[model samples]
Target: MQPLLIYNTLSHQKELFKPLTPDHVGMYVCGPTVYGDGHLGHARPAITFDVVFRYLRHIGYKVRYVRNITDVGHLEHDADEGEDKIAKKARLEQLEPMEVAQYYTNRYHAAMDALNVLRPSIEPHASGHILEQIELVQKIIDAGYAYVSNGSVYFDVRKYQEDTKKYGCLSGRVIDEMLSTTRELDGQEEKHFSGDFALWKKAAPEHIMRWNSPWSVGFPGWHTECTAMGTKYLGETFDIHGGGMDLMFPHHESEIAQQTAVCGHGPCKYWMHNNMITINGQKMGKSLGNFITLDEFFTGKHELLDQAYTPMTIRFFILQAHYRSTVDFSNEALIAAEKGYARLMQAYKTLGRLQPSKTSSVDVKEYRQKCYDAMNDDFNTPIVISHLFDMAKVINTVNDKKATLTQADIDELKGVMDTFVFEIMGLRDEASSDNTALIDGLMKMILDIRATAKANKDWATSDKIRDELGTLGVTVKDGKDGATYEL
Candidate 1:
């Protein structure tokens, strides 16, 4: 099998993964801001990195995955002068700031859990770590990389650029380019340069989430919490730092500068970014008003959707494409994915019932190696699914007695399916239930009646039983070997 090769944003190339420690790996992903319900945009990184977390553990690494929840310090997209995002939402809804965060955080987890995403090992909240944020700001100030103005602290971009010589490497941005491209904002008189960002913002009297710090009664900057919380949990240097590609600039770039200025070294060994989900070839962002919330998609509440899609269908749609490629959403595409997902899942169910023969007809070992190779190649899930489809074809042929499988081959095939489908891909058989015994007994009784009808050449009775069961959400398929039913 090929060694895992992940595309590193810092190096701008796909490099072989070598952990800093032999058996341990630390990964930090920038998580939700919790100001609103999670949209389709949020699912990308959660599902993408969940696979990374799963694969790393599957390959024998003890992984620590830290995904933070940002309950504070986010500003409106256009107006840095505007109110905190969560605070603004709370005022509109007449609720406390923490109340808003808790409500949406619960909703976000429910959506992700429905999609079968693995929960992160450590999910830290920004509001819970104000002291650590203040200490980090003080460290930057003590290092002469930040200065105070009217009880507010701002990182000195010019000073850090002069000291480090490369400030915007992750964003592929030059200092001159930022000075030229960045729009002038209203309350930036305190900043010495256009590229300088806030380490702490002095809160207005009306601000409800203010905390007292050495700077003033203020809130930490949007970028400061990630640097502080990430370092606090994962140490100064870790294995992989991941987020959406949109965060590659400004947010992640600022994070690198802050960490480097304080620790005299960069934060992580590898940087990974998942590409955006698009609509009509444009990025789907909250500010753009083009995004559909996960709830909206599942409930068919969006004007653009034709009908609701199950969580497994959404997961299958995402895994059908490479993580690095932008996946465009459409009703047609979703319908296709839904059908394809059902076919694969049905085959997975059929594999268990196949009888083993003395002689093997399929090369199961080679097929298993291909599955591993696809995953090792930058976690290529699309290709892995293609391999699964091939396996499905073989399983179907063998079920028809056109092919054969030895006992060892049967065991290896089952292991491969379980690893790729359940463990690495993070997909579940959503149709499964604990009431299988009851459902199976009922279906058997109905099938017995149908068998009697068929034996008596009463086609009308047999067809009625099949049609009625189909309307009740159970599919009955008849073949020469036997009749099977699935719900």
Candidate 2:
């Protein structure tokens, strides 16, 4: 099998993967803030890194994946002037902050589960690790990289830059460029430098979620939580850290600064960033107002969607595009993906029922190797899926008696489908999961009776069974293999 090569955002190039420990891999991904329902924007990262997690494990690596829930420390906006996202939601709903967090967190998990995303090994919450965050802030201050002004603590970017040479390495922005691009904040006198961000902000009189720290009763900075949580779980340096490409600046950059300030080294060996999902050629973001929620997509309740798309359809649609590419959402694109996914899945089901021949006519082993080659190259799921469709053509040919497959060839084909279609792609038979067995069994029995009626030239009884069964959410069809029924 070809070795896996992943694009590293830090190096700005695709590099061959080699775990820090021999066969062990550690990955950290920034998860949701739990302030509201998960939107389509949230699904990209969840599914993108989910593939990474699955593929790593598939390659015989013992992987430890840490994705955190930001129950605290996420300000409503980039500016420090807004209310806490969770706290504001709590007040509006007349619930505690934790209550709001729990509700949204469960909602997020349900959405992910529906998408078939595996839960992370450790899902640390920022609110639950106050002491660790406080200690980190203290370490930064003690190291002279941060200072407390009034009751708030801010990272001294000037001092940090003077001490550390590659301050803006991840963002590729110079301090002067940031100073020029960033809009001036109203209350900026406390910060020593224009780019310096809050390590802790002093809580207002009506602030809902405040915690006692060395500086004052304030919450941790947005970037500090990931650093503390990541280091706590994955150690000072781990294998990979992944998030949306939008987080490269400020969020991931600040994480690099904070981790280096305390631990004297960067947190992760590789940084992977998945590109955004676009709608109408524009990036789908919360601030853009073009964002659609996952619920809206699943229900087809959005104005832009033509019809409801099943969870598997959405997953297949996403996998159709390379994760690094910006996939534009449209009815046409989704329809195409839906039909393509159905074709592949139908062919997969047909593979099991195909009769084996004494002689093989195709090179099944070579085709299987090609599938692995596609996946090994940066987990190119789209290319791998395309190859699966090609194999599907072969399977269909064999099933139609236009070609042939030996017993060994049939076993190889089954193994290929099982590995790539189910194991690596993480797709399950969605139609088979919901009362399909019982429905299929009952339909088969009914179809048998209908076949006997047809054999006896009893047109009335056969048509009655077919028409009644069709009315009751089942369709019976007469085929070469007797009759088959479906709902």
Residue ranges of candidate 1 with Cα displaced over 4 Å? 76-78, 285-289, 434-487
lDDT of 1: 0.89
Residues 216-279 of candidate 1 have per-residue lDDT tens digits of: 9989988888899889989999999999998988899999999999999888999999998987
Candidate 2 collision pairs? none
**lDDT for each residue of candidate 2 in 1-487, tens digit (9 for 90 to 100):** 7788888888888889998999999999999989889987788889989988988898799999999999984853447455777777788889999988998999999889989999999999999988998989999998889999878888888888888876788878889988898777754787788788888888877678999987788888888899999999999999999998888888898899998888888899899888888887887776777778888888998887889887788888888888888888888888888898888888888988989889999888887788778877877899999889889999999999999999899889889988888888878778778786786677778788888899999999999998998888577777787887765
Number of the predicted model whose lDDT against the real structure is largest:
1
| Lowest lDDT 10-residue stretch of candidate 2 | 73-82
Error of 2 at 242 (Å): 0.5
Provide C-alpha RMSD values for all models, in order. 10.1, 9.5
